[model samples]
Target: MTREINPFGLRMPPELRELLKREARLNGRSLNAELVARLRTGSDPPDANDPPPRGMRLRTTAVQPRNGWVPTDAERAMLTVFRKLPPEKQLALLTLFE
Candidate 1:
């Protein structure tokens, strides 16, 4: 089945356009697809390479822990679960972020 297309024009500051363009490139999406996806989600985009391919290059990025860093709610929740894992499992899981 073919979905009908709706054409719309948008106007925004040059900076915002650049942000969207960069996000689109990083996400491996066309600008229109990126915009539509964000609008549908009704939330901000994730970090520049958050999940790796779509955000951060996880395995390659350095861990630059801030001087007084704190985990976000999601990170805290993950830590709560991590604390329950057996020693072997904890080490295995940490390998992914290594």
Candidate 2:
């Protein structure tokens, strides 16, 4: 069986073309196959040695404090300041912790 592929032409910078060619060779795929796979996935394929995404890594290490755990004075002060922030400001500050 054959899949119908529409013919399309693209003009890219020489550097980008070379990059795609190199990546295709590294992955043992034809240039057309590499381009098609990337288009389907909407991004480059993940490398096995790459670190997990930031959010995933953060969630994995997150720990829930014991029921008896209490915040230190510094933590309490920080929380107090955080609570005083406006909703938008609070969200912006929270992203910094991420």
Candidate 3:
């Protein structure tokens, strides 16, 4: 069953929205429906649950030098505020611009 998620307001660019709609249609679903499906499935979707039929697992890792970056007061405040938000909210903030 679907429920009212945002009763007040949310915003997105018209062109981007149209592009998303077109892509969703090409894949046989609505944008909202696709998002809801992914959300309900958690971080990894259903298809990723089992070992591959080929019995080979693909893995990747990136190694980076540890150069500690000191946080400014503003950065620290923002991190504190951001950490307080729910995972969904954090993901929303991360994706909202991109």
Candidate 4:
């Protein structure tokens, strides 16, 4: 049986919303369906049977610095926020920094 979906209002920047709309159109999905699909996949663990995409590999553990350096308060706070993001968004941010 399928669970019922409750409607909720969300506010986002206009540019972000437009980006989502464009993605939805490109993917042949409605805006609502695109958002729902993204939300569902955001929290789902990767399937073991699926191979990693080219240029990307999944790591079982996070890498540590050679010197075991400590993070500042601001860096720690940023890390906390980063950890709360969805995996795709995290990857996007990391790619941006790279």
Top candidate by lDDT: 4
Mind giving the per-residue lDDT tens digits that candidate 2 earns over 1-98? Answer: 23576678999999988877866665567878777766765476544334333111122233445454556999768757866665446556656877
lDDT against the true structure, each candidate = 0.62, 0.58, 0.51, 0.64
After superposing candidate 2 on the true structure, give the runs of residues whose Cα lies further than 4 Å from its correct spot.
Answer: 1-3, 43-98
Model 2's TM-score against the true structure: 0.40
lDDT of 4 by residue, 38-87 (tens): 77765677654443331233434544545676569997688678767765
Better of 3 and 4 by TM-score: 4
Worst ten in a row by lDDT for model 1: 52-61
Cα deviation of 48, candidate 1, in Å: 19
Write model 1 residue lDDT over 42-91, tens digit each, in one string: 46544433343332223333444545464599976885786677544655
**Candidate 4 wrong stretches, greater than 4 Å:** 1-4, 48-98
Which pairs clash in model 3? none
What is the per-residue lDDT of model 3 for residues 3-98, given as tens digits with 9 covering 90 to 100?
Answer: 656643448899977765754554457887654544564565334324221111222222232454445899668757866775446556656656
The candidate with the higher lDDT, 2 or 4, is 4
Report how far off residue 73 is in candidate 1 (Å): 11
Give the winner by TM-score: 1 or 3: 1
- For every candidate in turn, the CA RMSD to the true structure comes to 12.9, 14.8, 15.9, 11.3
Between candidates 2 and 4, the one scoring higher on TM-score is 4
